[model samples]
Target: MTKKIFASIVTICGISVMAVMLLITALLNGKTADSAAGHVRNESRLIASAVEKGGSDYLYHTDFDKDMRVTWIDSGGKVRFDSHKDADSLENHADREEVAAALKTGEGSSSRYSETIMKKTVNYAVRLSDGSVIRVSGVHSSFTAQLLKLINPILLILAAAALFSALAASMVSRNIVKPINDIDLEHPDAQKSYKELAPLLEKLRTQNSKVSRQMDEIQSRREQFSLMTESMTEGLIIADPKLMVLACNTAALKLLGAGDFHKGQSIYSLNNSDIFRRCLLNALGGRRSECILRTGGGQREVIASPANSIDMVCGLVVFIMDVTEKQELETMRREFTSNVSHELKTPLTTIYGTADMLASGMVQSDDVAQFGENIRGEAERLINLINDIISLSKLDEDSAPRENENVELFALAEEILDRLKLSAEEKNITVSLTGENVSMPGSRTILSEVLYNLCDNAIKYNVSGGRLDVKIAHAPQRAIITVADTGIGIPKQHIGRIFERFYRVDKSRSRKIKGTGLGLSIVKHGIMYHNGTVRVDSEADKGTVFTIELPIEKKNNEQGEII
Candidate 1:
């Protein structure tokens, strides 16, 4: 900016100076030409008067310089005297305009002409006492020749002065522009110090400082907001008026499979699930909405709210929550309620029938005692089923792990195998343990319960003469425990719900075997409480394998103890 202004100022000053110099030079040159012409005319008049006073002999014999040519014309328009040539041979000057004007007005004058010997002629007319007109004619070169001689030095001096003034003006302008160019708009302390620019620079510094501070404050606020968004468990996304992704949180990226969500990427492209797309469109139209979206891997319940007045400029902020587990729990709860009612009804019916038979004396004396025992056993089974249900409900409510304690995984597995060995022996099934000793951080009671349940289930479901494999191994970062059984293998459809509370592959068969469906659910909850995962793989009539993985060392809590 400074350079541009300097160039403009310098250019204007240079042009003005040059113009004034040229104008003055032209005027002076004109005046000089006029003065020189006047001098020549005076010289011509003096010579003509001298010649007229002294007669024809004085004019004809006059000894002026050779550079000056003199001639005289009579009233008859004939040349009377000539210095350069004979009077009889000279052309008549009476017809010349200058000579005629001088003759009639008795005044001398000059005019330009083209002739053989002269470009211009100056004439002086004097009437002598003898009543004969004496006109003296002198020829000279063009006026341009004399003007050049007079003005050349003046023109050269003016040209030199103009050049010097231009050079000086450029230097001064550069000095004035340099500091201004170096002034930093980003830093208020760095600015021009010249007195002329002080006020403007000060104002600029104040405005720049204010803007910089405002930008810094906004940046700080943005960082805090980003931190809050990242820390949230729910996935968040913000879109533009066109339903394009503008901002997203860490949870959103994870939920969306770490997909790119840069500017101009349509919200629908992030997840093509129909429900998600509808939510995005509805939010963009300023409507708060919600939808459950199931993707390839998981399901998300999204709650979209139109942004407040500040964020209405774009679209809206959509909150996403992973509700797959919650939905499964709700389904399990409904199924559990229905199953418990059915299960209790069957045992209660048996007890009621047996007691009525005894009360009615329908059974023999010997069978009555047996019937009473059968009713007691059925009542006990009902009590156990109710207790298991209560325990499962508690585990579900307290999903968080308790304080961690080191537990011997191999010992726990061995104990569970011992407890179920008798049942396995009755069915002619063998229970075998494999792998090395392993230790993990978890509640001993929970670990023992998980192993007991898994082993019992394995034995109960195993076919006669089948084998059960209980393996405990140490992995890179976790302890793996697997229970595999050659049992009446679960169907593919039933495998997914096997760990759900009160779910059974064959309700009648499970009841005949005195199998409590809560076993697998208990195992699942125990493993989950230990911050572990349980997965099952099975094939119909082939076998079923249940694998549990638990971290070796639990994460430390804020109090610096394992949690």
Candidate 2:
């Protein structure tokens, strides 16, 4: 601002001074020319008077200045006398503008440039009373010559003026800019500056307030975003188009096994896996990408989505999810479906074959009864398989009854044993229920199912004359039930997966026993529904003991206890 003001002031001064100088020079030149012309007219009139008084002797005797010329012409247009040149050698004066006008008028004057002398000649002619003309001409420097003569002095004056203008411009510009520079931008309204700047200062105040509010709002939103991302179970990462990490959550760092992550570092610095790099690159290319990365922790699903603005990708928002559990669940679901199909097909096929034989009369009258019995038995197996599937589905989807009721473990065990009395008798197993009645809050139906399945499995796997014991007791914050049977015990290798749906320890033996393989699975799910735990202790050719513990309260009493 100071420099601009200084330049403007200097330019205006220089131009103004030059214009004034030119005007003065022109005015002086014009005045000097007029004065010289007047002198010529007066001199010509005086000369004409003297020539009229003394005739040709006055012009011949008189001496004039070296720059001045005198001539006398007769009415016949002939130069009769010349002061500077011979009268006979001079040209006819009647053809001259001043002389011709003087011949008709009383007096005339004219000016012309004389290239020979490089000066302007001013001529004045007067008609003499003797019927002749007397002319006097004076030569003076031209306007160009006068200006040239003044050039050195003009230059000296301009130099002095420039120096003065420089000083004045400096002082003036400083004064003009000082107030503006002194104003406090943070408190513009408090400054006593120029009244002309009041509006600008007010606007500055308004803009400051607006900017302050916007900054606060942005900070608030940033905090909220940070909170949300930090609290997420899924890992989240934000990166620029250059693949530089802008933000990363704790979950992301843990999921990707990236320790002590810092922002603005390359994302590859976190995990330089091929799949990670490929997904990010695809997002930068404006395409949404997803890939699974197997880290030490587990399988992580990385989803990179481009953040777009105006048809152009600006950055990337990446989500990393620990899909290890989800993938395993999906695998289990598929296996369950296949197993259910296989289990149902066998029964349906058996029933279909037996019924078809009976319907087509292929079986003899005596064998028809056996065929009908086979069909009925297969249909019953199909119905039991379907029921078990429905129960397992309900448990998987948490769609079972949630209402709890007080259930006595001892009484429930006795009831289950009574229901399986016929099966126990078929195996020649002696069943006994003992121990005090341990009461707990639970879903009655699920507990009953749990007790019934454990008792039924005991009888089915028992040897002839085996012993079955159902005992109920109490432990700290728990109601305990133990079901022990002298049966072909489960092998150690199969104990872990015995609770899985349709998992049979001995397939052929289980087929002959004629029981759905979902009994232990149902018992496991029912125990889980009551927030209880079940343990199996077994050895081949010996006996297996099933111990179940149900929480007395709805919630577990132990801290950090994993069921």
Candidate 3:
């Protein structure tokens, strides 16, 4: 706009200056031409009157401008005297336009130009009384020559005018654009600007308002997306087709073991492992891919899916789940199935073999009773194994109803000790009960099983002459039970998995102890069902202590009701 304004001003000023110069030049040239013609006519009449008195001597004696010419011709068309030429060589004046006119009308005037029109001649003729003609002529500048004579001045004036126009145009253009430049686009004021620009300002204000709304909306959506992604427990990542990380959550950073994560960083910067790259590249190629990535923290399942738009793969979204616990559970399930099959097969095979031998009557009469006794013992072992299995299944599935009752921990500990008295005797272990007889709201059947398992494990694993102590205490809202045994304590490495089903510290010793390995597992699950916590303390070759704390008031557990 500024350039346009400046150019327009300069163009208009140049045309106006040139127009004024042309008009002035034409007026001056016209006045000069008229004055020169008048001078020639006056000089011709004076010369004619002088010729009537002083004839040809007046033409010779009179000194005029070098540009002036004089010619005298006789009535018979012969040139008698010439100022700038020989009278005999001059052309006859009888046929000349000015002289012919003067002879008929007494006076005549005419103008002629050179071939180039650069010089003009103004001629005036007069007829003398003695049948002769006198003519005087003067050279004058043509319009073209006059214009050429003023060319330098005209150019100088135009140069000065152009310089002035440039300066004035610059100032005017700035003034014309100043209001627009000063306008505040964020918040425009139309009243302070030109009235002609009010409509444009209003339109600008409207556009600003619309853009502001769109910007605010975009910011709001961005914040919402950030909040949602940040709150996710599963690791999430969004990447462009070039594998640049567009968005990532905290969980993704932790899962991928990434540090100082920033947008636009390559996904390989987070984890450059082969499995991660393979899955990501597959997704970038428009194929969904999944793989397990093992890291220092745990195992993660990475699922990468292509984000498609209009049949084109625009980007990718990756989901990472910490499946360490799930993998561990799967392993445990397989091991439990294998161990259960082995354990059930052993007792069944023993019972079947003993009964079959008795039925076949291959034994002599002296061994019949012994055979029967062996069969009964093996059968009882099978039944016990089945019962333990059933108990574990019930705890795992939580498919049985539980009836609430007030159960005393000390009494429960005493009852468990009584039931295990013979086992304790066989091991030559001493048993004792201590602490308050605290009672908590729970199912009596479940509480009995919990106390029995702990006490049973205490006696079963204790060495001969080892002491078993069961302590019960109560807090304001919880019942605490501590069962400690002076048995071969668990090793440090195996302590973490002590409560796992069929997980024995010494498998040979445990098998010889005449007990199933599901007792500790049952104890753990029963305590969990009661909304309680259990912890173990032990050292190799020393003893193991199991401490349990249960809420006095019934509360809902994760699986089912506490009752």
Q: What is the TM-score of each candidate against the true structure?
A: 0.52, 0.75, 0.82
Best by TM-score: 3
Clashes of each: 0, 0, 0
Judge candidate 2 against the unseen true structure and give its global Cα lDDT, from 0 to 1: 0.86
Report the C-alpha lDDT of model 3 over 6-110, residue by residue, as the tens digit.
999999999999888888888999999999999999899888888888877888888877889988878887998888888888766788888889889988888
Candidates, ranked, lDDT: 3, 2, 1
Judging by lDDT against the true structure, name the best candidate. 3
Residues 365-455, candidate 2: write the lDDT tens digits. 9888788888889899999989988898887677887866888778777778888989888878999998997888878888888888888
Estimate the overall C-alpha local distance difference test score of candidate 3. 0.87
What is the full ranking by TM-score, best candidate first?
A: 3, 2, 1
Worst 10 residues of 2 by lDDT: 554-563
**Per-residue lDDT of model 1, residues 1-563, tens digit only:** 54565567667766775577567656765675465467556666777677656767777466865655666777666877776789898777777775677567765566566655435655555544443455445555544444455466656765776577567766877787777677776663433456777777778879988998999999999999999999998998887677777878889877766576665687776677777778777776778889987766587888888765764645678888898889887887788889889889989999999999989989999897799899998999899888777767777788444746889888888888888778989999988999999988878877887888888877888899999999999999899998999998989888777877777788878867885579888887777676677778888887889888887877533211111
